[model samples]
Target chain A: MTDAASLSAPEAARRSLVGWLLVLSLPLLMAVMELSVYAVEPRVLSLRNIVNVLDQASYAFVFASAQMMVILTRGFDLSLGTSVSTVSVASALAMTGLVAAGAPDALVVAAGLIAGLGVGALVGLFNGGFVAGLGINPFVVTLGSLNICLGLSTTISGGGPVFNVPDVFSRLFYNGKLMPGVSIPIMIAVLIGLGLYFLLNHTTFGRSLYIIGNNPRAARVAGLPSRRYLMFAYLACSLLAAFGGLMLTARTGSGEPNLGGSLMLESIAAAVIGGVSLQGGVGGVGAVVFGALFVTMLSNSMDLLEVGGYVQQILLGCVIIIAIFLDRLRQTRA
Target chain B: MTHIVDRRGAGAVSQRALRGYARVGFLPTVLIVLVVAMALFVPRFLSVQNVFNVLRSSSYLVILSAGQMLVLIVGGFDLSVGAVVPLASVVSAMTMVWAGGAVPGQTGLIIALGVLAGLGSGLLVGLLNGLCVAFLKVSAFIVTLGSMSIATGMALLLTNGIPVYGMPKAFVSGFGRGLWFQLPTAVYLAALVVAAVWFIQNFTKMGRYLYAIGGNLHAATVSGVRTKTYLVLAYAVCSILAAVTGLALTAEIGSGQAVINGQLTLESIAAAVIAGVSLKGGVGRVEMVTLAALFLLILTNAMDLLRIDPRIQTIFLGLIVVLAVAIEEMGKRRTPVD
Candidate 1:
C-alpha cells in the first residue's frame, strides 16, 4: 500500500509533482481567465459578486458531483435533469393542493419535499430496473426514462410552470442567508460535496463502484453484487439531481416541467471539464469541485463580457470537446 | 393465450421462420394487430387523409431513423443528428431567404444550390463527429453529444431565436406542399432515401463492412476492414441524412426555427430497436425499420383520433420504447438457454 516504499525519493516526488501539475493547471488557467475578465469589469471581481457567482453554480455542482459518481461506475444517467424537473413539478403540484386545502404550511412544505425525493427514487427504480436487471444499455435506457419523466411532469403540471410556492420554502433553500456570510444554497452544496467525498473514499460501496467500473466481470467473479451497486449509483445520481431541482424550485419560486432540459448537457460538461474520466473510476473529489467551479466561472466571465447566451453555449461545447481531447492525449501519454 | 402451433417438430425452414418469428416477425405482427384494433374502434383511423397524415409524418421520421440506423449498425450512436436537423432547417431557410424571390428560370439553380449548402454544412458536422469518433479515439457517445451541443448552439446563434421568414414561394410549395399521385413530395424523397439505404446496405462493400466492425471492432480491425474510414462514413451519412430531413421539415413549416425536435433521436432509436436493430450493432434491415416507423406513426395517429392527451401519449411512447428494449433483452437471454 506504500507506493514510495520501493521507489527512490526523487522518483516518487516527480510522480506526485506530475499528478499535481495535471490537476492544478486547468483550474489555474481558468482562474487567470476569470481574473482577466475581472480586470475588464472591476465590479465582477468584488467579493460579493464572486460569492453570488458561486451560489449560482452551487446547484450545478450538486448535479455534477452526482453525475461524476454515475460516470465512475461506467454508467451514464441522462434522466437526472428530467428527474429533477419531474420531482420539482410533482412537489410543487402537491404543495399547491395541500395549500389549497388549508393544510399547515409546515406540513405542506414537508410533503412537497418528500414528494420531490419520491419522484427521484421512482425514476431511479425505473432506470435501474432495466439497466441493471435487464442488462439494457444505460445510455438508451436513461434516454427513454428522461422522456418518460418529462412526459409525466408535463402531464401533472399541464405543461405549465407551477407557481405560488410558500415563501418559507424559498427562504430556507433558495437565496436565503444561512449566516452573515454564508448562503444557504452554497452551504447545502458544500455539505453534499463533503458527503459525496466521504462516501466515495471511505465506504466499501464506493470502492465497489471503482472496481466494477474498471473491470465489471472481474468484480462479478469476486462476489460483488454488481447489479445492486450499479442500481444504487443511479439512485444516488437521480436523488442528488432531484435535490438540486428542489433548490431550483425555491430559487425560481415556481416549478417548471422542462427546467431540466439543459441540465443533461451542463452537468456532463461540468464533470468532463473538471477532469473526470468518462472511461470511469479516474476522477477525484477535489478535481470535481475545481471542475464545477471552473465551468461555472467560465460562464460567469462570459456573462461579464456580455457574451450572448447562445454564444456561451457554443463556447461550452468547445470546452467539452477540448477537455475530452486533453483527456485522450493524457491517456496516450501515460 | 392458446399455443396453437406445435413448435417442437417444426422443420428447418419453418423453424427458421419460427426463430425469425420470435425475433422480427413478432413486432410486425403486434403492429398489425394494433392497427386493426384501432381501425375497428377509432373512426377515421383508416381514412385517406389520416393515412396520408401518418405517411407524411413518417416520411421524415423514417428518413431520420435511417440515418440513426446507419450509425447504430456500425456500433456508434450519433446524437448529433438531433441537432443537425435544426441546423439544416435554419440554414436552408436562411439560404432561401437570401436567394430572395425565385425567378422562373433561376428557381431550379437556386434550389439545387440550397441543397448543396445544406448537404455541405452537414458534411462538416459529420466530419467533426466522424473524425473524433474514428481517429481521436473518443467515445462515440461523448463526441456526438459534444457535437450536439455545438450544433444546437449554432442553430440558435444563426437565428437569435427568431424564425427566418420570406422563403421563396416556389421553394416551399415544391418541396413541402407539392404532391404526386396523391402523395406528398416528401414521401418520394423519403422513398428515394430508403431505397438508397437498402441498396447501400445490401449491394455495397462498405455497408457490409459496417456489420463486420459492429460485430467486433478489434477483430474487424485486425482483419483489416479500415474501421476508421467506415466509422467516419457511418457518422457522415447519419449526420447528412438528418440535415436532409431538417431541410425538408423547414420547407414544410415555411420558415426555419431554432428549436429541435426533442424526440427525434429517441424515436429513431426506438424504431430501430423495435424493428430488431440491435443496439449492440451489426444486425438489422431497412425494410423492417421502415415498417417500424410507419407503425409508430400509425399508433400516434390512432391515439390522436382516440383523444389521448399529448402529454400522456408521450409517457406511453417512452414506456413502449423501454418495453421493446426489455423484451429484446429477454429474448437475448432465452437464446442462450436454448
Candidate 2:
C-alpha cells in the first residue's frame, strides 16, 4: 500500500479493476436489476420513484452503516433491532405525554431524541461492559439483550402500536423538507453516512477501530484504547439503531413494538453484501451506503416484478450466503 | 496453558478455587436461592401440579439445549434449530394426518413414518449446513444464519403460516395424556434423551474429537483428526436431536404450530451458557445443560406465579443468561490462561 505511488501503469489498472469489483459490483447489480424492472414498468425509473427508494433506504442506511463499523471490529449487535424497538416505544410514550400536556414542539422533539438515544446507550453499556470487561462472547451477551429489549418493548406497548403522537413529530422529523424537495430522513441518512466516513478516516478512535479490528494483540501492543473503542463501537451501533427506529416511528406516526423484526439480519446483509469483511478491518462507509441502497432497491424491484414475499425471503437468504462466499474467495486470494 | 493444568492441584488450592468457580458458576447458587425464594414468597410455587407443568413445558427447551451444546462443543452454531422445530413438527403433523388420519389398523406404521419424516427434514438441514460449513469452509455463524432464514421461509411457505391440525388421537393420548409414574410421557422421553446424549458425549470418540477441534482447530487437524467429517457428523447429530424434541413437543400439543418455539435458538444458546458451556466451545457437560433447563423452568414458573406477563419473563430469561455468563467469565479472567 505504501508503494502504491510507485506502481507501474498496468499494475495501477489492475488495482483499479480490483477496487471496482469489490466496491461497485453490488450497486451495478442493483442498477441492472432496476433496469430490468424498468423494462416491465417504465414508471419505476421516474424521479419520484428514485426518491421513494432513497426514503425507504434511509432507516436501514442508519442501521447498516453503524453495523458495518461494529462488524469491522469483529463484533455484532443482534440487540440493535430490539433496542430500536424499545427506544421507539419509550420515545413514543414520552412524546405522546408531552404533546397531550401541551408542551412546546421543541421540547417534545428534544425529549423524544433524549429518551430514545438514552435507552439505546444504556443497553449498549451493559452489552459492552460484559463483552469487553468480562471477556464473555459478544454474540451471547448481545443475543441475550436482544430478547430483553424485545420483551420490554412489547410489554410497554401492550403488544401493539403506541399512537396519538404529535403530528409535528412525524411531520417535521420524517417528512419535512430539508431543502426544497429533500426529505428530512434522507438528509439525516446522508449526513450520518458522511459523518461516519469522516470519523473512520480522520478520528483517532476510528483509526483504533481499524487497528484493533485487524489485530487485537497488535492494537494492545500499540497502546490503542481497544476495549474502550469496542465499547464505543457498540454504543454507536445502538445509538444509530435508535435513531433509525425514531425515523421509522415518525414515518408511520406511531411506535411499533414489532418494527424491524428482520432488521438485524438486514443490517448484516447490507454490510456483508457491501463487501465488508466479517473478519474485521476491511470496509468503508461509502461502500456501505451503496450496499444499503442496493438492498432497498432489490426489494423494490422484486415488488415491481410481483414476486411472492416468501420466495423473496428465500432469495434474500441466498444473497447473504453468496455475498459471504465471494468474501471468502477474496480472503483466500488476498 | 498445558503447564497450569498439569500443576492444577499441586500446592495451588487458591488457583483451584478459581477453577471451581469456572466449573460451578453462579447457576447452582442462583438455583438454590431462586428455589428458596420462590418456595417462601411465590404462592403455590411448590405445588405438585405446578412442578409438573414447569417440567412439561420446558421439556422441549432441555432437549433443544442439549443438542445445541453438542454443536457448540464442535465449534458451530445451529441457528436453524429455531426454524427446524416448526418445520419438523409441522411436516410430521401433516404426515400423521395424511397417513394415520384416524386409521385404526395402520396407525402404528403411519405414526412411525410421520416421526421419520420429521427427523428426515432435520437430517437434510444438518447435511446442507454441514456441507456448506465444513466442506465449503464458510463461517458457521453466517452459514447457520442463512440456513435459519431459508428454513424459516420454506416452513412458512409449506404451512402458509397456519398450524397443522388434527393429530391422531392415539398419538396424542400416548404422548400427552398418558402419564408414567405420575409424569407426562414427554418427561420420561426427555430423561431418556439426556441419558442418550450423555452416553454419546462422554463415551464416544466423536465426542472427544469435537472437543479437540473446538479447542484448537489447526492443532486438531495437524494431529490427524478428521475435523471435516466429525464436524458434519456432530451437526447431523445435533439437528437429529432437535428433531426428536420437536416431534415430541408437537405430539404433546396435539398439533403442529408453524411459528411454534420462535425463541428456541436463542433460548437454547442461553441455557447452555448458563449451564457453564463456553460460547467459544470445547467445554460443557450434558448434566449441566439438563440442570440449566430445570433452572430455567423454575425461574419462569416462579415468575408465572407472580402473575408476570409473558414478555417480562422474556426479560428475566435474558438477564439470567447475561448475568450467569458474566459470573463465569469474571472467574475465568481472574485465572491467567498462560
Candidate 3:
C-alpha cells in the first residue's frame, strides 16, 4: 500500500530511511498543526469547511502536479499560468458549441478533456523541442513561452474571460456530490492524484524520467531517449496545467483569462515546500499532492482566523523560506 | 599546400568573428538598422525630443540590466530583481507618504532613506542567495526562485496588497522633476551607474575572478581563487543595482506597483543573455548588455509605432530568443566549448 515496495533497491538505498521519514513526517506534522488549529476553531472541522478546502485546493492540486513533473525532470515551467489561461479559453470555446449542438454529456466531457490535453501537448512540444534541440536552458525557454502563452491567451480571449461553459461538464466538476454530502471536486483531485502516482511510479517511462533527471547524459547512455523523455515531461506538465484550468473554469462556471495567475508561484512553492527538489530526479506524486493541500489548508486556516492578506502573505513567505531551509538540509543529508 | 591551408585558416578566423558578431550582435545590428531605417522612412525617428523620449524610457532598464549583467557574467541569475526593486520601492514610498505629513524637508530625507533601503534590501537578499549557493551548496536556480517568492510576499505584506502613493512633493518631486541640460537627473544617474559598471568589469581583479569562475568553477577553485566570496559580491552588486533600478522606477512612475515583476524579470534576463553574455558565464561586456537593452527598447518602441498587439510582440520576442539560442548553439558547435 505504501508504494515503497515497488521502488528498486538502488533507488531506495540511495535514499535513507530518514529521507523517507522526512517526506512522510512533514505532511503528518502539518496535519497535526491543522488539527490543533481545528481544536481552537471547531468550525474548521465542519464538513462544509472540508468541502470548501478540497474544492479550492483542487485547482492547486492540478497545477502543482504539473509543476512537479517539470521539477522532477530537473526543470521548471514558468509558462504554466499562461498555458492554463490558453487551454481554458480554448476548451470553453470548444464546450460552448458542443453543448449548443446538444451533444451527449459524456461526449462533451471528452471533447473538453481532449481540447485541454491537446493544447497542453502542443505547448509542451514547442518548449521541449527548443530545450532539447537547441540546448536552451529550461528557465529561458519557459520564460519566453510564458509570455507567448499569455499573449496568445489574451489575444484569443480578447482580454476577457471565456464564459458559457457547457452545463454537463460543469456539473461533473462543481455540482456533482460524493458520499452523501462531500463535493465532487475532491473526487477529481483523488483521481488526478492516483493517475499521477501510477504514471510516476508504475511505469518504465517514469523510471526513465527519474534516471534522466538525475543525469541526462547517463540516461542517454543507458539507451533512454533523453530528449523525448524531456519532451514528455513538458507535455505532461502542460496537460496537467490545462486540466487545472478546465477544472477552475468548471468550478467557477466560467473561464477567466487570469484564473490561475497566482497559482504559478503557489504551485512551485507547494512542490518545493512539499519536498520536491528543484534539482530534479527526486519527489513523488503523493508529496506534490500533500504540498498543494498543505498550502490550501494554511490559506483556509488563515482565512478562518481572520488574518489579513498582508499578514497572510508574510506568513506564507516565512513558510517558504523554512521549507527551503529544510529542503537544503535534507539534500545535504542525502 | 601549406600556403593554401594558412589562407583557409585565416579566412575561417575572420568568418568566425563575423558570425560571432551576428549571433552576439544580432539585436544591436537589428536595432541600428531599424533606427536608421526609421529615421529615413519616418520623419519623427531622429528628432532630439524623440531620442530623449527613448532615453528616458530606457533609463531604468539600463540600471536593471546592469544589475542583471553582473550575475549573468558570473554564471548565476537573480530572478528576484523584479520583486526586490518593487518591494523596496513600495516600502520606501509608503514611508515617504507617511512622513510627508509629519515634518518639513521630509522628502529629501526620505529619498536618502529610500536609497539606503534599496541598497540594504539588495545586499541582504544577495547575501542570502550567495550563502544558499555557497554554504548550502544548493543550486542558484532554486535559491533565486525561492527568493522571488519571498520578496514578492514581502512586498505584498508591506502594503496589505494595496498601492501606496500620495507622498509629499519634496521627496519624489526633486528627483522626478530635476533636470539637467533638458534631460532628467535620473538619466544622468543611470549613465553614471553604467559607466561605473563598465569600469569595474574591465579593470577590477574581482571582475577577472568572475570570469574565471564562470569559465570553469573547478579550475577557479583549484587555482586558489575564493569564488564563493566573489559570487557573494556579484550577487550583492546585482541586488544593489536592482534596488537602484527600483528607486528610479518609483521616481519615474511616482508610485509603487506590485504587478510589475511578472514578466519584467525575464525581460532583463533576456536582454542580458541576448547581449552575448555566455550562459556559461565569463564572456561578456557591459557595453554589449547596454546595447542589447537599447536594442530591445527600440524593437518594442517600433512595435508600438507599428500598432502591433502587445501579445504578438511577445510572440516575436519568444521567436527571437529561441533563434538566438539556436544561433549560439550552432556557433559553439562550430567553435567547440573548450
Which DockQ values do the candidates obtain, in the order shown?
A: 0.64, 0.66, 0.48
Q: Which ten residues in a row have the lowest lDDT in candidate 3 chain A?
A: A1-10
**TM-score winner among the candidates?**
1
Question: After superposing candidate 2, which stretches have Cα over 4 Å from the reference?
Answer: A1-25, A38-43, B1-22, B40-43, B101-104, B335-338
Query: Chain B alone: TM-score in each candidate?
Result: 0.92, 0.91, 0.88
- Estimate, for each residue in A1-334, the C-alpha lDDT of model 3 and write its tens digit: 1234356878767887888766566676677868988888988889888878877787778788899888888888888888888888878877776888988878888888888778888889988887776667887788778878777878877888877887778788778755676667778778889988888788988888777777878898888888888888888888888878878878777667787677778888888777787767887877777788888998899899888776776677656766677666666554
Candidate 2 structure quality by residue, lDDT tens digits, B1-338: 45556785656766776577655666777789989998888669888889788888788888989989988987788888888888788889888888865564687787888899999989988887888889888877778888778878877788888888877777888876668888988788789989988887789888788899888888999999999998998788778888888898888888876788677888888888788877677888888898898898888888878988999888987887888777776777776675
In terms of DockQ, which candidate is strongest? 2
Model 2 vs. true fold: TM: 0.92
Residue B13's C-alpha lDDT in candidate 3? 76
Give candidate 3 regions above 4 Å deviation.
Answer: A1-25, A97-110, A178-182, B1-13, B16-23, B97-103, B106-110, B160-174, B256-261, B278-283, B336-338
Task: Kindly report which residue pairs in candidate 3 clash with one another.
Answer: none
- What shift in Å separates residue B336 of candidate 3 from its native position after superposition? 4.9
Q: Which is the better candidate, 1 or 2, if ranked by DockQ?
A: 2
For residue B46, model 3's alpha carbon misses the true position, in angstroms, by 2.9
Model 1 CA lDDT for position B42? 77
Per-chain TM-score of chain A in candidate 1 equals: 0.93
- Ranked by DockQ, the better of candidates 1 and 3 is 1
Proportion of true inter-chain contacts also present in candidate 1? 0.61
Interface RMSD of each: 1.5, 1.3, 2.2
lDDT per residue as tens, model 3, B49-145: 7777778767777788888888877888777888888877777677676656566476667666666766687778788877777666766765787
